[model samples]
Target: SADETLAHLQAALKRRRRLSDQAQMLVRKAMAYIHSHYTHPLTRQDIAHYVGMSEDYLTHCFRQELGTTPVEYLNRYRVLQARHLLAESDKSITNIALEVGFSSSSYFSRVFRKEVGQSPEEYRRLKQSSVR
Candidate 1:
């Protein structure tokens, strides 16, 4: 009785661990797609298709593994690319925004400020001053 119950619990645990690993693999695939394509316009449907999962499942796995939505992750990735350009390039903020897949400079600035705590121009100036 007790022994049988213990065996069942162990088997369930093993199955859960296996499923967790599989889910993590799917999330990694999704992330790879995002990293490669973050410079283009993308949607959750696109990511789901690339990862061979339904959109809702992809979203669930991504959030479970990464603790953020796919769109937020994409925005953060773009912001990081923008940061690199700001520090090293002479491109205007608008050009950099568009270069990084942002449809509008204002939206890019808004996301940048939310993520980096500074406007793009201010960030660039601060970075430049620190380097010099």
Candidate 2:
């Protein structure tokens, strides 16, 4: 009886592992879609539709895989792009913000500061000065 119970547990564990792997793949697909479209206006609903999952389930899967919401991921991606633009381009902060899909310069600055520990202008100055 103990051996039978152990076999049942092993089978259940294997099924769970397989399902977890599938869920992880779906989350990765969602992430890939987000990365490709990060410069566009996107919402969780849109991501959910693209991933063919309900919004709640998508959120659960994303959080399970990435430990952050999709919106947070998108915002972080935008901030990263803004950082690159800040360091390499002479574009104004507002333009960079818009280019990176932030709705407003102020919002972009706020998010950038929250994510990067500096305003875009300060970041640019620091990075540019280091190059010379």
Candidate 3:
């Protein structure tokens, strides 16, 4: 009986390992898809469609794998790109927001402050002052 129980546990462990590997691969694929399409408006539905899964399932899977929802990940990525543009380009804040795929400049400002602890203008000013 002990040997049989050990064998069953080993088999179950193997199955879990296989599923974990698959989830890892799917997360990687979803991240790659986000990196490529983040410049455009994206939704959880869009990511699910690209990954060939339902939105609910993709959300659960992505959250489990990455500890954040896909939408949140996209927003963070957008903010990162916006930071670069803000520091280097003379583009308007609204333009930078739109270029980074935010739907509205106010929304961009809100999210940017949330993520960076500063508004885009403040960030740009700080960066420019430091460079001089």
Determine which window of 10 residues in candidate 1 has minimal summed lDDT: 1-10
* Residue 50 accuracy (lDDT) in model 2: 91
Candidate 3, residue 91: Cα displacement in angstroms equals 0.4
Which 10-residue window of candidate 3 scores lowest in summed lDDT? 1-10
The CA lDDT of each predicted structure is 0.82, 0.81, 0.80
* Clash counts for the predictions, in order: 0, 0, 0
**Stretch of 10 with least lDDT, candidate 2:** 1-10
lDDT (tens digit, per residue) of candidate 1 on 43-126: 999999988889888878766656578788788888988999999999999999999999999999999999999999999999
TM-scores for all candidates: the values are: 0.84, 0.83, 0.83
Give lDDT tens digits, candidate 2, residues 1-132. Answer: 234234433544454343476776676677778778878889999999998989999888766655578898789878877888999999999999999998999999999999999999999999999999
When sorted by lDDT, best at the front, the candidate numbers are 1, 2, 3
Model 1 has an lDDT value of 0.82
Give the clashing residue pairs of candidate 3, or none: none
| Per-residue C-alpha lDDT of model 3 across residues 1-132, encoded as one tens digit per residue | 234234433544454343366665666677788878888989998888888888887888766655568898788888988998998999999999999899999999998999899999999999999999
* Shift of residue 50 alpha carbon in model 1, Å: 0.6
The reply for model 1, stretches above 4 Å from the true place, is: 1-19
How many residue pairs of model 2 clash at the backbone?
0
